[model samples]
Target: MHLYYEVSGNGKPVVLLHSGGADLRDWTYVVPFLANHYQVVAFDGRGAGNSPSPTEPANYVADLLALLDHLEIGQAAIVGHSMGGRIATDFALEHPDRVSELVVVGPALSGFNFSQEFQEWMQRINAAFPDIDKVIERSFDAPSYRIIKSSPHWELMIDMFRHHLKKTTEWGTFESVWPEPPAIDRLGDMQVRTMLLIGDEELPDNIRTAECFRDIPDFQSITIPGADHMVTLTHPNELCRHMIRFLGG
Candidate 1:
């Protein structure tokens, strides 16, 4: 359960969780800025980076809980991206009082409605070459996706992608990881203050997902202009500023 991680600064703790197929290194750009005001801890999720892979998808939650237990962190803010966000939502819901606050970026929780355009976009992404190398290359070379490519953390992003793809078995990814249930309904019970972050240019469904939690008394959301789904990498400073404000650093 000793997942690879990096921590810096000295203040109230803030844990950063990477997205699917990404590692603790993915937050290289954002963590330093956040570290200025708050202690920042970034770690790879189970099955990614240096974390051990589990046979069942649900074990990820256990892995996260074990991590928290190991760290002896009683209460802390959590900033999670994509798959990490889903795990964060679950953690907050199950252990409501442990989270001081929650920040979710590009969260992919299920059960939200999707428009036709958004559906088509999902299809396109799914249809994209399943090869991680090609996907990483396309992600960088695409003109519209240049924002992330320009980030100081871009090299780490690419390296993380390469590492996951190399460590993952073809069947393990398809069978053990993909096609798992999501944490959409469980979010409503999350009692901690939660801020959902997404990019202005992101797909409509992603935006809608953020909107879905707007009515929750503790839920809020914000969108960054000129940013894509990879907002943390593309606008790390801005993202850190918002997180600092939300986390009351």
Candidate 2:
């Protein structure tokens, strides 16, 4: 099934990928700014947002490639956040010729071992069984939501989560999207122009994950202060500035 996607403007192809539980709406704050100079596309990956439910675990890298093919975009830059970041990295690694530039925000690697703090936090969550809203606030909203607590966008984000939260657990877990021979192990071989963005206040695991790519040639990593995992929503202008520069806008 075709994914639910939005395309705007008419320039170089630039695709926006969202985080684990988020759909394309994750890019709402950044899309118009980018559309001014890019053929910006945002889509709901399988089982997220308005996309069709998955029959089994998805090969998201391939799915993304197919999406591009469907759009007749032979080559394009990719901008992804969290789970989307993981997919973007995987795609660049798997199909280097198709990517012009890569941007990953708060990426999680396929084989990345969770930081000790994250593992402990998961254990705590299981023990306490916090409500879904509480879970999102802890895992996604925390440091960032506090920065935009009074805004309508914050409430919109929360509502989006409430709507998509059902499928997250039902579709697949961590092991679903993970293919053997993870991305972290093959970083040395990938030379795609890459820019990494991480929120300084995000979970320790994510901060640790982004650090792994720092030494790769042609790779750039930036940190946004007072932000959390969902930096696109929390700090759109700052992210757009960095992305526009890297994208040569």
Candidate 3:
């Protein structure tokens, strides 16, 4: 309930969960489009953006539930990007009745074994550690970020990454608790209407993750041409169009 959040327009609720290494600003371009049709709730997840750093192991799913309870929203269409998508998927799985629909953009799936190359890439970034610039530079070097680096939103993306990295230095704990058995093991059990969005230029691990959700009974998948991992920023208009269609707005 203490998490920072912004609300716009009015209709059935639509909650926006941002990607990791960024904040609610991730939804800046997409909000305007969706807000016109539905009540949009954009929030800074704990330890990201203006939200307070986690004092213990982070419980993102619980934080989301608390946010809904605080807002008195009984059910909502949940839209998430990257790590946010992971949280959204888990939330729908654990609290199906609370999620009217689910949409994941370049999502990370729990229990999906990322390729060794991806793991090494992350390890290299972590090796940079306290050197924020190096970490940021290495992060943007990933294939998934190839498009965003050249987009007009490049500086803003960098700013958010810089801020998030700096804030991590102040966190009490780095652990984020997720539902048991992992989402990969439970995708088939997801009952909420679902959609998966990915950029054509996305990393292989992410593409595979998207495939994992394809078998879900009510799932839909979209690949934004010319987009990369930062589809939210680089292709917000296209993303919103697909989302509105899927959500029936």
Best by lDDT: 3
> Least accurate stretch of 10 residues (summed lDDT) in model 2?
139-148
Tell me the deviation in Å of residue 17 in model 1: 0.7
Write one digit per residue (lDDT tens) for candidate 1, span 201-238.
Answer: 76556667777667557787888888876787778888
Each model's RMSD to truth, in Å? 3.4, 2.4, 0.7
- Stretches off by above 4 angstroms in model 1 are 56-58, 112-146, 150-154, 170-182
| Location of the lowest summed lDDT over 10 successive residues in candidate 1 | 170-179
**Candidate number with greatest TM-score:** 3
Count of residue pairs whose backbone atoms collide, per candidate? 0, 0, 0
Worst 10 residues of 3 by lDDT: 129-138
| Number of colliding residue pairs in model 3 | 0
Q: What's the TM-score of every candidate structure?
A: 0.83, 0.90, 0.98
Model 2 clash number: 0
Pairing residues by index, what is the TM-score of model 1?
0.83
For residues 1-249, write the lDDT of model 2, one tens digit per residue.
379999998899999999876788889899989999999999998888888767776779888989999999999999989989999988888898999999999988877898676687667655544487567656543354465565557776776677677766666443356555888888878879999998777766777788887755799889898777777887899999999999986
> Sorted on TM-score, highest at the top, how do the candidates line up?
3, 2, 1
